[model samples]
Target: MTVEDPLFATPSSEDIERTMDILGENGVSLVHLQFSDIAGGGRTVSIPTALLPRVFRRGFRFDGSAMSGGMRQVEVDLFLMPDPSTLVVLPPLPDRPRRAFIYCWVTRRGGQPFAGDPRTILQKQLNRASAIGLDYRVGIELEFYLYKGESLATASFESPHVSPSYFSDSDVGTALVRDHIVAWTHELGLGVHGAHHETGPGQQEIDLRHLGGIRIADQLNSTRQLIRVIAEQHNMKVTFMAKPFDDAPGSGMHLFQRLLKLDDGTDLLRGEDGADISAIAGHMIAGQIRHASAMSAILNTTVNSYKRLADGHRAPAWATWARVSESSLLRVPSTPEGTLTDIELRSPDPMANPYLAIAVALGAAVDGIEQKLDPPGAFDENLVHYNEEEFARFGVEQLPQTLGEAITNLTHDDTMREILGHFIVDQLLTVKRAEWDAYRRHVSPWEHIQYGEL
Candidate 1:
């Protein structure tokens, strides 16, 4: 069967031969078949290099029943179909085995696409956009923190540096390690616009140039792996957690999205005469806002993720759109050319599954267009600063304050349920509800300090 993905091209026999040759030249003895699990964690199946021929022809079988994120009903075997176009030789790291990585597609028995596969779920959404003669393009700003790995045992996130600086001095301990990361990112063909020190010590941000279709999701997964590998090489560690420290600014994966006409290469969100809000742009924004609460379950999955939403350090609390408010869920970012065509969503954390996150956003915008949804007017004033009386007048509402609340909102949103698929949704509800319950029952240090005295 033909792959429906916009970026997938069937690999020729010659392509397969060349990939094997390059692996030998790079001194690689293992091949890593990579795919993302439902919780956005990267899963890999490693095998010896001698088995490429059998892998290409018959595919490698694994027990999917044991691997699923608690959503399985029966034991079934799944196969990994490799994408040859993503071939790259990973750079050498300390005490690490050299391996060539190939991103794979999960298929059920007889080579049918697995409904629960994260990559398959995203591809379906891309096809939907293509059917309407439009393409979804996304640029992501990924934020993460670097820590001295040994300090993790103490429960204090110890950074290599001591202060918050926008751009750290070149002599910082993690500076050289950061350079190695950027070099390898370019080696993998994921173009880097730039990297810099963020507001918190040891926190760094990397921005990639935007791409269309499933490539963006693929890029995010690959990039995260590279970051972890490089950090381990230096005997350090990195985290993409949404809220790792209560005193520090949380790491968020901000999404900058645009829609383009499939045939003519025209940007559909392009505003007339540099106006902030275009007709279709307005509708897309409205549609996303209409489903914002439900979409939060996909964008911010963890219980700790909701802490950042309380918003004193540049995160959103209200589901409002604006030109420059950091506390608004969506912002119209200013560009060098003064074009406000792209929509910037600030809520998604680095921990989110890029496949599901992008799919939900694109699907919601498409719904907006089909339903002619009208978004409320954009506000310039900060949303977190608003009083309850002011919020009611603008028809504004707060986002889900906790994971349980967000999961409840998701169950009520039929549009998001349809977009994310019932199988995925069912698994998420069961998994997340349990997570919420676990967190509620666990006692904390603050709880002991307050109630123990009484």
Candidate 2:
């Protein structure tokens, strides 16, 4: 299909006009066209609200070579055409002009969608699912740490107790941050379910209601931005790093997903009995399990992400599925009588580009359905405590231990390679491999303390 086909269609003129009118009514003076780079970093360029109409017509151009992930110096020119459907007014900040934000799709000079663009990569996969009359719905639980300053040395709070202070109501600092985040996210139209203190000191979590794939991705990006902005207003810094401290609990972007019938919105994953999973759910879980190892490279994009996947940290270290165990790579959360059911992927972190992460995941699920793949039987018991012999008997496999190993797995996994496409994969590997190499060559305090005198 063409780039402007139903899958990635540009917003209609009427839709753009309506959005412009809404922005005008909201007192928005600047319009920010936002996009995500390959490393999940947010990028933006702002224009006066009056210029948005011209942007919609001609598309904004930039030098992609300046960015980290997608383009090289030789082919530097890239265009960002804002998707007007994503337009939303930013929450007002004191002493700042009211602004609006719209996500953009990366295209070439001639307006063809850039294959290496993370959003386009996701849209392509969404189109694949749409072609089959299915819709992918996703909910994300984002975990992050709030600190007094940008570095650990300047951290404001430190707990002396060995036990975690999960859900504690006493930390007024963190509570205020959470309150602002919830308020701002709601103002931005993200359906905020709840926010609370996590296991680690100064750590927090926010859960957003499930929505369609693209919408959820957009909201996720917006959520991160708002969280950072709100925290800065309070003179605190927030980090979504998978593991910022070696001894503390790591952050994760736990993704809950399900499929629905396009025509009637019937949940395809629901079985006859509420307690049991349907056949389609099984196949999708099987697909996720089959590709879990390779998927880790993208889901856990940073080197520190591997540190969170250890045995006792609640992060899954094995490629296993279970109905209720949080220790498994995939878990089926218990649903109330009338609530929606979905699968939770525990491997992802906030460092991942949400667009690419969800795209590959849905692609795998669709492949599983198409192939009628059967996932391994559920391992209800905690696999972390299982001996190697028991794990072997159950055919459970370990996830890659390091970023290098994960990249190696990604290189060999044909299914994942096909889903993300060779171009995106090549670009990702090039960027990530360089990061791995730099990390390998760096000298750390631990290394110096261990070897300097010895």
Lowest summed lDDT window (length 10), candidate 2: 155-164
Error of 1 at 125 (Å): 0.7
Best by lDDT: 2
The candidate 1 region of ten consecutive residues with least summed lDDT is 152-161
Q: Which stretches of candidate 1 lie over 4 Å from their true place?
A: 1-10, 71-75, 94-96, 151-162, 338-340
CA lDDT, every model vs. true structure: 0.81, 0.86
Per-residue CA lDDT of candidate 1, range 1-454, in tens? 3344444454668877988899889998888998887777789999898897567666778877534555454536787778887776787655777888888887766567777788888888888889989878899899988877465444323453366477865436667777888999997787667788888767888887788757888888888888888887777788888888877888899989988888987878867785756788888899889999998999999998998777478888788898888778898877665442578988999888898999888888889988999989887786656787898898987888999999999999999989989888988888888899999999999899999988
Off by over 4 Å in 2: 1-5, 67-70, 158-164, 273-275
Q: TM-scores across all candidates?
A: 0.94, 0.95
RMSD of each: 2.4, 2.1
Q: What is the alpha-carbon lDDT of model 2 when measured against the actual structure?
A: 0.86
